[model samples]
Target: MKLDSAGLQVLSPAECVELLASTPIGRVVFTDHALPAVQPVNFVLDGTTVVMRTTPGSKLAVAARNTVVAFETDEFDPETGTGWSVTAIGYARAVTDPVETERLAHLSGAPWSPDGNDRFIVMPIRQVSGRRVRVRP
Candidate 1:
């Protein structure tokens, strides 16, 4: 097993995406009230875009107002001493087109609030990067 100065092996982009796709929950980071805010969201990888659902008054409504946002996802297996993380920086927009709304609705993200919201947001990544760490005993 090979290790870096930090004592872990680094993973490639393909590896990172593979790990990311293994899970459906990710963090959306954006500036809110002049500070960075992150929220856990349920998302699906639609080609290169990340699609999720949110309520009307949610923080996403504010963060996404700037059009640019950072989204990330990760997973790890402690028992195996391995993990990976993927981050995407992109432009986010509310999907309002009837065709897009219908298409996104078919994807798997459920509302996080009790108000039964049906709004869909799409984040189209302009740049994507990721890393993985593995500690071999």
Candidate 2:
């Protein structure tokens, strides 16, 4: 097992991608009026791209357009102190092409909230890293 300076198990790039695919929800960090903001969003991994759905005029939809964003997802077992976290950084863009949008719509079945949240925000996984808490020996 590989460990980082903080004593956490270092996860490989492939591992990180796997973890990202295993989870359904993640937090997206983006710049909001020159300040940092984070929002929990439902996402899916599409060949190394983080895909999320939001309303067309929503804050996230606006802020993430052609902007660099940080996405993160993780799971933990607090009782045993075992868990893993994955973070991916990339530029996000809204899906404007009609054909592409239609294709992505079928990726995840049923939107979490079907209230006019049909726009797709895609963030390609350009840089990713992950870490796992060291399980007790």
Candidate 3:
């Protein structure tokens, strides 16, 4: 297995994409008001693109538009001390086509919150990398 400098198992792009598809929630990092910000979002991977729903004109919707951002998701077991993290960096764009929006809405389902999150932001997985930590046997 490939290992990074820190001894963590280096994951391939396919592995990273698989991990990303397995998780429903992730953090999106973007620049907000000239400062870095991270927000947890409910997302689904449509192919290699990360699709997230947000209300129109929301902070994330506004700030992430046509900008490069990072999306990350991971899972860990406390007792085993084993985990894997996947991150995807790419440019984000708001889905504007009506047909595409309708298609994505079905895939996305309802928002995590009660608010109506009608806007869909799509980020194609341009660059992906991941690492896994496994406890010694």
Candidate 4:
């Protein structure tokens, strides 16, 4: 990673994926009413894909299907002023196959806040980028 943008280091794709796997919670950015919407979700990294649960008839279930979305996660230290941020943009779709859903079930785990989470959605990470900011001591 090389420093850029005010002491920010650009992370490699592998590094970005590693950081994503380390975190359980992330935000999904999608479209709502033709406008942008963001929602926090608990997700798991299945290889290079992101799998999460959503309820039927929910905004996520409806809006996210067959669409492009941006997922992101980050960790920051105020005192040390050091942290990393990762962003992934890709196509999202609902898991329709029962067998595939069962396979993914082993990886997704339980949702953070359950609300009839009967639907499973998957997002294939198409483009990923990350940055780390390290403040001087």
Candidate 5:
């Protein structure tokens, strides 16, 4: 797919959701210590939110200080020369509500972290977009 001058390719919401569900890992982008940082995170897609776990006092904790964030995931088959990427722009927050946390705990697949693994971080999606790429032979 080719991006327009603004470096964006319009994609349907359903397409974005589909891409998000197909991948178990994504990159979370945020600002930390006055600089931008990105972290690889294992996440589960919960309809409109992406959930992951991170340790306390981590860069993620500092970057997601009640601020907007970007999360992205993609799948590529180099042998088949096809792939798709999806990105979600949303607000990042810690899961503090007991009810919500309890419900999210039931989601399949747990996040892996070297730090304390009990803390959960969630990104509630506000906007999503994606694009598919096909390599020319």
Candidate 6:
């Protein structure tokens, strides 16, 4: 855990995970055709692992599997100049195991896409870093 009072406050690993899980949507960054790409995902945090569903033919399905990826979510207020951002970096893997997929499916909000939200991708949180700033007075 690290802290800075003036410019930004560095959050602990636990705080980062908690903040990451509090949000319902996040952006996932991965490689697409060797070029970097970022896709928004409706995700749920399951004990520090981020889970989301994607269609079989979608680029996310093909591009994110078995790769190191970045997941991020944040909120801010323009008037206050205060907010927090947390990022999680880890290796992603498709959850082909039926039991685990079924288990994670019950965690939270329904996926934004159709196709029954069947394809599950899991990113186990390896490293989390975040910063928070105070409101301007």
Off by over 4 Å in 4: 5-7, 111-116, 134-137
Per-prediction CA RMSD (Å): 3.8, 2.9, 3.2, 3.3, 3.7, 3.4
**Candidate 2 CA-lDDT value:** 0.87
Candidate 6 per-residue lDDT, tens place, 16-117, comes to 898898888899999898898999988988898899777777899989999999999987887888899899999999987766666776665453333355
lDDT per residue for candidate 4 within 1-137, as digits (tens), equals 48776777899999999999999999999999999999988789999999877777788888998999999999888889799899999999998876677677666765233333467889999999999966544
Best model number under lDDT: 3
* CA lDDT of every candidate: 0.74, 0.87, 0.89, 0.86, 0.77, 0.84
Clashes counted in candidate 6 amount to: 0
Cα lDDT of model 3 by residue, 42-106, tens digit: 89999999998877868988898899999999888888889999999999998877668878888
Error of 4 at 85 (Å): 0.7
Rank by lDDT, descending? 3, 2, 4, 6, 5, 1
Where is model 3 poorest over a 10-residue stretch in terms of lDDT?
109-118
Colliding residue pairs in candidate 6: none
The true-versus-predicted C-alpha distance at residue 119 of model 4, in Å, is: 1.3
Minimal lDDT window, size 10, model 5: 108-117
lDDT of 5 by residue, 1-137 (tens): 55755665656888899879887789998887778889997788887888876667677765675789999898778789877788899988887665666666668454333343556688889999887756533
Q: Which is the better candidate, 2 or 4, if ranked by TM-score?
A: 2
User: Which lDDT tens digits does candidate 2 get at residues 2-120?
Assistant: 99998888999999999999999999999999999999988878899999877787899889889889999989886787999999999999987766776777886743434545888
**Cα lDDT for residue 27, model 4?**
90
- Winner on TM-score between 1 and 6 is 6
Off by over 4 Å in 6: 1-6, 109-117, 133-137
Every model's TM-score? 0.78, 0.90, 0.89, 0.86, 0.80, 0.84
lDDT of 1 by residue, 79-118 (tens): 8987777888888988666667666767654423234366
lDDT of 3: 0.89
